[model samples]
Target: MNLPKRNSEDGRYYLMTPDAREKLQPLFDRCIRDAIDGKITRPDSLYPPVVVSSEGAPFGVHYLAMDWAEAQRAETFNVEQAVAFSENLRRLSRWGEIDHYLLGVLERELQKKYFVVTGREDDHRWNREYSLKPGIRAEDVPEPLLRFACYVAVSYKVYGLDFQYLDTNYLLGLVEKVRPNMVKKLKENGTGRLPLNLQKRKKEHFTASANDAFAVIRISAKDCTEECYSEVLNYLCELLSQEDFPRSYAVEFKGPEKKYLSITGLPKKGINQLCACAVQYPSLQSLLERYARLAMRQYERYTNLDDEQCALPGSFAVFALGMLGQPWRQLVWDYLGLCDDEHSRLQEKFLREYVKQFGFTADTVPIFVRGVLSMQSMKYSKDYAAWMANAESLGALLDAKARLSEIVPSGFSSDDDDEDDEPTDETEAGPEEVLQYAWETVCYVIWGKASAKRGLKVVETAPEELKERYRQIFE
Candidate 1:
């Protein structure tokens, strides 16, 4: 069979066809599925270990299709395995974008001995010879490609690492290196408005402004050549023109091999003018107020849209009200009417937490009760039902103007109530442990009033009428 057969009409992922699926079904069912599925439970920030069934598993080649988005590979493939490798290189140079790092790792593990192109652009005899690896089944492709593709499918879970944390001492050292050069330049070309004179105003100004100044300086460093002193001066002048930069600027002088010669400082009246401008307008408070209003409107738009599959809108609404302290009571009420499905229930639970946190009393009990109870059609676990029962009672107290502080049992909110005293032993508990915990904590709050109204434990399984109501909504 051809390697990397296009199984789906629209897919970025490598496909496993029905024939290939059946051929590999025993291996998947007996060995791979449980192991990989367990690994999938880990947080998205980590990459799961790659899996290969056997040591002698064949290598599969995947060619870039013309219809696919032009891939920008971060690295190149050096073909040291086959004569066809040279042609493969010629073809890939026109088609494939390779990640050299990932490819290098894969190459070592796979130990490339043949080069095969999955698709046809040439009918050369050498192409057919490498199309299928010897001793491999007609239904099977190479094991390495399959493993790589599976990893690619779930790679979206990886979180972007923050790279913006720069050490203060390291930054100041750069400033120390650059300051002396600026002073020398100042003597050669002094001006009242230049940053060369600004350093004399305050020593703290240099340290205070180094971070912003470094951002500009780093760009100049990268662009600086063997003889770019004039470029450095231009960068310093540009920093002076920006309102955000402080009173001082520094430049690092370069010696003959582009070695560091010295650092010089320049001072100007930039900070004084900045202070004068601050007095003319109190824009920070005004701008913050304006931004808050804009954020609220944007959140409103997010809540109203149904295009996204996730319950992000409900979370956004809760976050807006909880974190930003938005006074959008009507928006929260409107959000209640919109949440009617299993997926939205999670967001509704988050909203309930925000509602209770902000001390929404009996006046808001009806909203919580109706919103949470409306998801009865969803396949929420029995534990979730139990949580809903307890939550309903709290809402009932709010409805009857009862004091929650008096009703909540003593020690329930105490630190000793934590259940995470024991370390988690299972590496692959699936996501159920998290879901059950969410239901018990957040969802339990919203169902409190509904529990009292029905005279049933919130944790009890849903009654038939509730299920029917859910069906009716969908119908």
Candidate 2:
């Protein structure tokens, strides 16, 4: 199938149905009509916010106001925070017990200073009815505040923080005390009148963003003991270790040693940047579902073409993994059993298909290397290309190749090889060369050179022979 056209304005490639707007137009119209007619007491939270276009027909749809805040936050904590967090943890020797005190301190820091963690109050989608109204309306409630409230409530309930701060009745009572005229004015307006700023709007498609709330742990000026510090650090790590998705956020600690500790959900910033440039990522749950729909469609198309092979090309799956990144990468890998040793059937099948597709012989190592090198000549920016060509990455590829050789025989040559075939020098080098070339390309395409360096570092420390081989490659 042909690739989608690049959006001239943003240079993004998008796939949309031919009549997507026409199909959605009536639905948008009905939502506004019902809300105005009071047929529906509130707008449906399920639908994206709808505003009438000044030009008519094509009404503009802004994101779910809440998503704006999330995108902003996701782009904030970043990799530097995670690095700092990790470095600080390395300094502690004597760890203490993680009790209520540490959890309470972190909870208070997160909840009490909500404005700092989340954005300003004005940052939320402002609906007079939802923000000022006396009763609960799911659609009317600003998403950030609701989410914050949920976080605070959950922290108090689960972690046993002072629940008084989040008590619904106490909150309402404060509102009554402070803004007595608010509800009266809302009542006078009858059907909720939107603010002037929200009258007319424009809409854009959703891109997944990393809107995560991070916890920053800091030591007070008091002469903090090492035991107390270790206790706090351990507790934070424990909290960070819970689950992958919703619970996955950055954790930063500022200790007396002047070092910082951080743990974030995604990989480093450089890797994410490279992946972002190469492929569309699905950071948001909604976007993931949309991408899954597209993948399923592709799967069906390939299934019709051939049933003997795996559902998709393993190379294509590798490309998808790079695009997905982080938590999504692990999630996709788990779904495909890419990391499962017990399910080696798929991996072995992929290897056979790979050998056949490329027609690789034991003597074709140089050809494979050249193929990968030629691909690097594409019109990526000079900086991007430089990242892929760096020495550290070459070493990493060498290490990856060496390690993979242990699992798949180093003598693997072609799909037709028999058990009786002798392991010649050429055969021994073939599989390693294939892995080196493929992984080098994958790393270059997905994560650029920095991640490749990190990958080599893993092989350097984790295995003795690979480390020596890695040193030799770079030597």
Candidate 3:
């Protein structure tokens, strides 16, 4: 049928050609007869009728003609017009079955408008209420809804109202129709096959046996005195023998005897920079620093001795077995070896301290306890020796200051605000300046060394009694 060309200029009306009108006549007649027979009804019967543009609108033949003309001239048929038509048909006794015929017509019209049909008429009602944006195409329906449709099709062997005509090809056809477009979109967005490598790595890292030892050694001039290398070797041996550590990993003393003990298994990869030890530890940088210092001191001390006596290697492996499968609570309990009563007390004390420090209540105490245990594990690892040293220095400095405050009595001074006040000048300092000050202060107290002598004048002024007390504590 030759349909009238849409008017490009105004975009409102399209004249119905003779051929197109003839083609549409049968559908229109069927709808009209159905309406007159009370086979159709308005979906929303409570809504008020729309006001006619012209005065004294007629019913029956005249009304139908007016509506036909309006539909032809208008950009689209509005909700009010659709509802009025349905209601008029119902009143005329055109519809036989309210649920079957009326709902079927609505569904047909929605499909023609390119809506992906949902299994729910309730959803349709909600969409109308919310005035949801029209879907431009079938796939514009949400992914969850599409998946739900697929699931229903698979489980019930049904396709919409044609549920009785079960066919395997119907479900296969749906999948075939949607798959290509979905895959194309995924590829275009660079998401297809994106996570494969990450997933594989995680699987391998979690499943592999722990035969490799990850070691961090520190060397310094001070550690070389009094057979310090022998002592370090002894410590390494003890660490390897611990029941919790991987039995397959071993460390050798190699001192004077040039002998080595064989562990049950060893990883194919040798000790190298690229080898990733699966063990999680805190303050790795500090640990490495301490190892380097100790190593250097050993080298300096045993310079006169044979190479075998001075060179000491240590390693410890972490096992992957049950690592991922174990609950965090069980892991903590096993690691700490806490007795039943001690565990309860630990949980209570941890909860109280955590709430006070972090200012949040938790639903479970286990999560906070796990976090504390994790932190402790990291701190005690060989990797965190440097961090421990620095932390120790800071702790000592604070302790000294606290002792000084305790020993010295406050003098009767005019500056009452001094008791609680901070140095106001620091507020003006940039982040870099603040960071530099912190770093220097930490180094000075911990390592008894400072990179720069500058900024010492910024120290807060105290009363003569306080100053004397601080000096006495240091001395």
Candidate 4:
């Protein structure tokens, strides 16, 4: 089987076979569409830079895959940090207890050869990745070694590179699915009234972030001795012995006689850059849950517990894993399983954030959502090609925007508004600007350029609510 080989000239990697792209692009296309429609539990779990897009995409929908060139550099472990952590342990004579798997990883590092280790306890996605360093030719590696890499690379591809993307075409469709409850949420937030649910989510986000940041083990600097270091190492080993830990965790040693030791794990963000993986992706959540629990037991040992007393719960279910936005994901799956539905209901919280950003009046919000959705989901490929290529399509779009402006109100007054402060002609004119923003966003989302210029008219803008353009899919 042909695999990706490094180009001797430019010093970059390329997938060898053309047929592979042909075979796998369609599969990713299906998965991406399903994910956006709320079918997939962990939309963020799909490996290989899976993205959302529309129109020019290969599959007849808004989902596509794009090659992630930056992934290799980002995925490379921090060698300096890893080495210092190891050397400190060895100096303290705690290296013998370093487990076999980590030892292998360390050995490969010392030899100056490349080794990519998959994080343990994965979920719906095959997130295992590889790095083909500069100066390493394809011929140097065995065919069997890269076959799986080739398969995964192909499975989520669109065309040559663009393995995954941010498909804004369907965002309109997604926005159209919002419930009335969500509309009320938008108005509530506009009035500076925080919902109970958001208050809870805010607390959860804070706690999860604080805990992950505080994942450091501390011992007094005065107690600095080989025995103290070994004691800490033994605690870590015992913590790791339990299944409760992120599969990608590593222990980083601090300076000589330092008061603390940090167990650095994979950045909770994982492959989906915007959201943290510990709260969204199942496998990572399971591992972090394990890590947190294991570390807790170790902490208990430092105070009152003995070795046997510090054992973890044998069968802890990682429903929420103590991270923000995870329990709702579990509920989504429970909903799907019990109802046997193809897609879970649109998340009210998600829509709440949506309208919170746009601030559409309850009356006009649905209309605005429908207009954008129609523009995105509309299948006029020949027309879209013309639009991207020239000015007529954009002109028509702007005209449509003008027409939509007349009908759609920009915003609504809260109950606190005085009778004298009620909307007037100037207030009615607000939809013109709002709809102008909407169409500009539509142009940007569809075109992907910083600005869409046609003749002298130019539309340049950004997206909110979906700006990270990256979102987590609920299970």
Please name the candidate that would achieve the greatest lDDT relative to the true structure.
1
lDDT of each: 0.30, 0.29, 0.28, 0.28
RMSD vs true structure, all candidates: 21.5, 23.3, 29.7, 26.0
Select the stronger candidate by TM-score from 2 and 4.
2
lDDT of residue 10 for candidate 1:
24
Where does candidate 2 have its weakest 10-residue lDDT segment?
A: 89-98
Relative to the true structure, candidate 2 has a C-alpha RMSD (angstroms) of 23.3
Candidate 2: what lDDT? 0.29
lDDT of 4 by residue, 181-285 (tens): 322332233212223332122221121110011122222212334443333333444434534222122232232332211112212211111112223444444
Error of 4 at 381 (Å): 25
Q: Between candidates 2 and 4, name the one with more favorable lDDT.
A: 2
The per-residue C-alpha lDDT of model 2 at residue 243 equals 33
Clashes of 4: 24
Tell me how far the alpha carbon of residue 444 in candidate 4 is from the true structure, in angstroms, after superposition: 18
What is the C-alpha lDDT profile of model 2 across 114-154, one tens digit per residue? 32223456652221112333453334333333333333332
For model 2, which pairs clash? 61-203, 74-210, 84-260, 84-261, 85-261, 85-262, 86-262
TM-score of each: 0.23, 0.23, 0.16, 0.16
Candidate 2, after superposition: displacement of residue 118 in Å? 26
